[model samples]
Target: MIQLITLDMAGTTVTDHHEVEACFAMAAQKSGLTVSDDRILAMQGLHKYFVFQTLWEEILGTTTHPEWQMRVDNSYRVFTEVLENHYLTHDITPTEGCLELFEYLHIHQIKIALTTGFYRKVCNIILEKLGWLEGLDDTHVGTASTTIQASITSDEVEKGRPHPFMIQKAMNLLHISDPQQVINVGDTPSDIQSGFAANCRLSVALSNGTHAADLLTPHNPSLLLGSLHELIPVLEDLRTRS
Candidate 1:
């Protein structure tokens, strides 16, 4: 049986109306980078800093150049500002059926953990807007009365998506040792890749987020969902089979 369900924040549980991509585009433009929309979307679930670093390297054709770090720093700085302001000023809400899914997990006694590509400050901002941060400690670990059992951010780990550090850290905090007892759910390829890298029992993907089904399918997720509501039946089926 699955004991823990690790979910992605933006685009998965939280509604994302291409605002993130817009922020990235604005940052890239301000930093004088000629990145395309597809390229920006492709980097969607990665650490913001790393995304800039990689993009700068690709644009400059070498990481060793003196301007590379400066470009990365400038782009990331702008991105942070734009992203944080967007979340602070704009309306934030849970994705469709997110609350229902949370209720189902609660009833089934399955712990819910949120993992995000966002860093701490912005992540907290979104959570606060949705009131999902209530009752969580400084470390973002929730008690029995909280909405989620734990929350993990990319900044807290040495590496972000496509790496297992965040998920492993969540497992550690939740006292879950076996990946087989955990289900990873997200709406990005990096999220799915991270789950697989962590050896999760199921690396599920949602196609309605940042990327489309065609883009996420190449990552080979165990299951692909079109909406958050579809997860309940999948979990029920898993419980029965297990």
Candidate 2:
């Protein structure tokens, strides 16, 4: 029986299209850099630093620099501010039926854990601004903080998605040791790949993110849901069988 559902944020919990493009545009303009939309789209489902590292390498032909880091930091700071001030502030909307599905899972006593590639500060800021952390009396929803400056050490078993570290870490914190008891849900190929690598019993993919249906279909998720609202019936079926 499934005991927990681990959700990925960004393209999963929150809509990412207009907000992301706006942020990228601000960052590129502020930094006097030009990143193509194709490049940004290609780097979806990756950590911000990883995306920055790639863009920095492409634009500067080198990935590391104190000055460049500051520039990137400043640009992203402005970008986040813009997201809060404009994108989400004026038009923050949850994915279709996400709240309903979340409530359904909680009512059924299923534990929920949220993980994301975003660093702690950014995640907190967005969650706060978008009201993602508000009015929740539920204890089942757990989110793991991805320490922004933590150096990667040898003991780290995973890096990021397409690595399972984030979700695995969330489950470990939830005290759910058996991966088979957890359903990993997300909205991209990397999400599917990460859940697959984590050995989740059910890997659910949604077409609401970087990957389109054509790109995600071949990976063969345990289920592909068009809307989060659809999970209620799926979970009900799972419960009946159990």
**TM-scores of all candidate predictions against the true structure:** 0.98, 0.78
Q: lDDT score, residue 7, model 1?
A: 92
Best by lDDT: 1
Q: Rate the local accuracy (lDDT) of all candidates.
A: 0.92, 0.68
For candidate 2, write residues 146-207 as lDDT tens digits. Answer: 11111111123357777888777766656789999888888877788889998998899988
lDDT of 1 by residue, 1-242 (tens): 99999999999999999999999999999989899999989989999899988988998899999999989998889989999999999999899889999999988889899999899999999999898999999889997668998999999998999898899999999899999999999999999999999999999999988889999999899999998899999999988998
- lDDT for 24 in candidate 1 is 94
Q: Model 1 — which ten-residue stretch has the worst lDDT?
A: 137-146
Return the top candidate by TM-score. Answer: 1
